[model samples]
Target: MQTAKRLFFSLDRQTECVADYIEPDRYSFLEQLPENERYIPRGAGLSYVAASFGSKSISLGLSKFNRILAFEPSGEEPTIVVEAGISLHKLHLFLCPQGLRVPVEPGHPQISIGGCIAFNVFGKNQFREGFFESCVEEIELFHPQKGLLTCSRNENTTLFELTIGGMGLTGVIVKAKLRLKRIPSPWLNVQKIPFTDLHHMFQVMKNESQTADSLHSFNDFTSFGKGLGRGFVYAAAFSEEDTAPELLMTFKSLERKPTRRFALFNRLTIPAFNAAYRTLNTRLKPYERMPFYRFNYPIAEMSFYFDWYGRKGFVERQMLVPEAKLDPYIEKFEALLRKYRPQIVFGSCKFFSGKQCHLRFAGTGIVISMEVMPNAANQGFHDALDELNVHMGAIDNIAKDSRVTKDLIASEYPEYGKFRDLLAEYDPHRQLASALSDKLCL
Candidate 1:
């Protein structure tokens, strides 16, 4: 076991802190930490919020435990057992050779499997495939008092439900048995369709969501009047033809790029970037073929985009607005943007189809993600966004933005109180916790 003071950064680069960090090389060393002390398990530590560390809590690093324990390929649906600390990138590489993989995955390649379960992450085709919970068959969790427990839909059901999106408050995730599906191909035929407005884009998105293998839209928010919400929807499906193995880029773990001393995205540069990006995409062929992994995880090659936000970092807020309420929500959203003119550097939309559950981001609606520089002048804009989202009955993603208040989350998610009560019932002492849990009182 190694103990030291380590500085950890949130994925957005907004928060950084020095925490007592512990890395145990073996299972026996995991017992060294005082059973009663509070600590949060750390995987890749890529959460946008301060989820893995706190000022007073110990951060238990699980990187050393990353490994594929077993694989069963004989069944109609094969399953793989992997340690919690394995990165999705590494897992994909292992599954690729066997023509098997998980269906739902968040964009980043560096995110850990344990983190995916803890957050109940969604993917490009979330509307069709469902959340990360749909991919998990069983979980092995460890709590100081409860010892080790096996949880699934049929066993320790409540803990299974809670631990899926429980934000690591339930206990330490040791490993999991994840259900897998066969990969149709190692490549995707991506079709890019440009739209003149948000409505037009969403219309195409809605239609494509029904048949496309994966779908998402990008919008240009730099201009308002005629140009507002103009962007492209990139819909992709697995290709029927296979490319030579040597032609594809090798799958590897991604590294976080160092941020610049000063922010590159601001009022002056954001508009230029948006225009150039739209132009570049428009000039490309309408349909293109590429490695499936590249489309699923563009961030693997674009990590420097986050680094451009610099030391002060940026704020990313993602929210889900019901399709029925989308018109008014967009009207309200545009009005807020026109009124405040927050320099929205990037905007994207995706379709989600799932019932609301325990603070998880899953829902039946259109999910929108906006990234903005966290400048002093933009504080009011962020606050107005909070109000607008609540007024429009949109559920703001709690994991994406650390600034979301407990009141805001409570007001939006009907099950917020139930989650709190359940957590209290399970861990009255709250032995497993983090800065995020502390803030939300979870």
Candidate 2:
């Protein structure tokens, strides 16, 4: 047990203070904090690098607070009130049966609703459904000072908007009432399309989602740009009619291991994975009736999947580029990846046009994500990445440097400062401010 009532650091990914605890237990812990004491809320510990690290404050771990509080029937927009600590994966189990779902889900479901709401998470579906925030009708907050505050789209509208993508700086999200979608039996009618490179591929995707379901695309560094690293695409839509439940599968015998070790932090093995994946996937064009979870989050064992990068301590870099600049940016991005050749284990890219979030990262554009070993002597490549990030055509730099400059935030998010101001009204004493809140410059 960490034996001090003082600063107890917790972290995830790689950092000094990786927190542990789910939402249920975390709720209990927060209610017991030293009165008026400063604390940061954390869930799943899946912030990629160090989103939850904090000093001079209690690290409120909400891992155990997870629970499907209440879920209603699907006749009139099935809805559920969930503990903030509940993982999105578990949430799916509750809704999948009714063919209902939260409109927006990130690539992986291990992320907690507390985190997702704070980040105002969006997905390929956003071209249609918007973001995870859109699925949320209301949220309940627990403040160190205030006992409990109920906020909803209709009641406390400002609180609701600020809490979305607010990064837990506003208050501890104890519970949330999220709207669920009616589906055709928890199956995704999926399609896989290949592009010579980024150009034709991205174009087709944007057009498809304009009138279709969710979509996500990725560039195989081993297949496109002077290499075999072309692009692989996955587009999915819910079925119109109910389908039979998928036979429950098991990973224990499936053998979906990533790899034992890295030969070097270069691009050799990655390209091979890309080639093999593309070959097998090419045969899967217009695949149909897949389990929704499989289609949404490829890594079904999300808890275990997150740990895969840890065997070697990895980091992910994500960038949101506006639609107009996506083509030119892809040209440069592909060249940069080829030249650097960092051992990118896996990655996914997708688009979104969500409700404007103060300091929120997504906005009617493309978000590219890549996982890599942080200390693989890849500084030269990392430097190039930094340069590209600095000059990416239309991306709001607020997403990249939210920690450094508040001005950049006002520039990109436009309303971020207002969000912070509202946050101040809710938490004037700065009791809920977190390392992420500080970094997001909110």
Residue 430 of model 1, lDDT score: 90
Candidate 1, position 62, lDDT: 83
How do the residues 183-224 of candidate 2 rate in per-residue lDDT, one tens digit apiece?
Answer: 766677777877766676777677787656878776665543
**Worst lDDT 10-window in candidate 1:** 246-255
Give me the displacement of residue 331 in model 2, in angstroms: 3.5
Candidate 2 segments exceeding 4 Å error: 1-12, 18-32, 227-229, 249-265, 284-288, 302-312, 338-342, 375-377, 380-421, 439-442
Per-residue CA lDDT of model 1 for 1-442, tens digit only, reads 5568987777777667788899877766665667778889988888889898887789988888799999997789899999999988888888876777788989877889988999999888897789999999999998877788999999999999999999999988999999998877788888988999877888999899877989998899889787688899999988767743413433444333445578888788999999888877777667788787788887676656677888777899899998889988888888878878787899999988888888898778899898987877778888888888878778988889978888999988889999999999998899988888888878
- Relative to the true structure, candidate 2 has a C-alpha RMSD (angstroms) of 4.5
- Model 1 lDDT, full chain set: 0.84
Q: What local lDDT score does residue 18 receive in model 2, on the 0 to 100 scale?
A: 29
lDDT winner among the candidates? Answer: 1
